[model samples]
Target: MTTNAQQQLQRYLRNARYEVLPLRGVVEQVRELPAGTTVTVTSSPAKGTEATLDTAARLRDEGMHVVPHLAARLVRDSAHLSDLLARVSDLGLTEVFVIAGDAERPAGRFTDALSLLRGMEEIGTRPYRLGITGYPEQHAFIPDRMTIQATDEKARYADYIVSQICYDPNTIASWVKSMRARGVELPVYIGAPGSIDPSKLLRISMKIGLGQSMRFLRKQHGVVTKLLTRYTPENVFDELSPCLVDPDYNIAGWHLFTFNEISKTRQWAIEMADRLQEVPA
Candidate 1:
């Protein structure tokens, strides 16, 4: 018989958003997703906000629900912010994910996600659904207390939270519980890496400053060996599925970091969702 948790996992997999980069051939890869899929375009300091916005627009035109990342540090000032928002509006996009970003220094007046949120509000134009980043584990540079405080403040402007990629289910659950206890009740989308090569995953994880999660990944002896081949989030799903059905977690759904491996990730998601449905119920 199919367990309730299994059914929940299936549903989440089906509805989960696929996060993609603004790299070459990404739009074509995303086109393979089922109609109406929600695809989020990530911002890269190397590529600039224009790349993110342009890719998002292309995906939107292709009939996908597109949410582009608006890295605060990439935005120059209020004028720049307004221009971006106008572009989003022109594209008919209703959602965006805001982050402090990976930029070493602020490009303009907005230094952080919270400041960017305020800037959006000041502009008197904003997406209907706004997402902000959350940290299940301690950030590499920001103190835990400060992250918490920032989230609490950003909650006023954000419609939801997408956690930074985390490998530990316990940590994610605990963080969600803590957020609730602290009265920040926005629905959370758990971030998990899509099916990808382990070496690539590690390199990207390190590049993004996932220090604690990298340590956790390193400590998994068996998983480390598997790194010679490929890595899948199957283990992560198996351990975290139970939390999906629990009301306390309020997990909106998975936010699969496809890392531009859309074909492989989409196939895995489809197969998993199918497997769940085929189970006796």
Candidate 2:
């Protein structure tokens, strides 16, 4: 018989969202995913918000449920925000993820996710579903107290929270527990790295300032050696699966950071889902 944990894991895998970048050949790779998959388009300082929206629009046209990131630092002002919101409304998109962005300086009035969220409310053009970022591990620049406070404040306007990618299951579970203790009731979607090259993953993780998570990986016996080959989230998932059945955690599902390795990640998700189904219920 399938255990409760197994059933939850299966359901999470089936409904997981795939996060993709707005880069070359991404659309083609996304086409390989199952029909109506939720595809999140990321915004970056280099590519700008237009790239993210354009990619999202294309994917939506191809019949995928697309959620584009709106980087606060990149938005020029209220006019720009209105224009972007209009475009999104035109596309009939009901969801979006807002981030403070990686840009060194704010382009205009909005400097953080909270301000942008308020700005959206002021203009009366907010999406039906808004996602805000959460950090399980301490951020490189933002202090822990501030991160927690900001999350508590943003929770009022957001429909959900998507945590930053963290490899340690204990840390993730503890963070979720803490969120509940603090009364932030938004459903969380755990951010996880998809099946990808270990070396590349490490480099990207470092670049994105996942210092504590990187340290945790280094402490694992033989984990660094495994970096020469491929890496998977099986260990993390196995350790975290039990939490999926816990009501207080309210972990809605996984948000796989495919990093544009859609083919490999999609295959991994499919195989895992299949394996879960094979267990007798």
Whole-model lDDT values for every prediction? 0.87, 0.89
Error of 1 at 85 (Å): 0.5
Q: State, as a TM-score between 0 and 1, how close model 2 is to the true structure.
A: 0.95
Please provide, for model 1 over 147-190, each residue's C-alpha lDDT reduced to its tens digit, 9 standing for 90 to 100.
99998999999999999888877888889999999998899998
Which number leads on TM-score? 2
TM-score of each: 0.94, 0.95
Instruction: Give the per-residue lDDT digits (tens) of candidate 2, residues 1-281.
Output: 34777778887887789999999999999999877899999999999999999999999988899999999999999999999999998998989999999999999989999999999989988988999999999998999999999999999999999999997899999999999999998999999999887777878887888888877777774565364254587778878877876877998999999999888888888789889888776
- Assess the local accuracy of residue 31 in candidate 2 as a C-alpha lDDT between 0 and 100: 93
Error of 2 at 274 (Å): 1.6
- For candidate 1, report its TM-score: 0.94
Positional deviation of 121 in candidate 2, in angstroms? 1.5
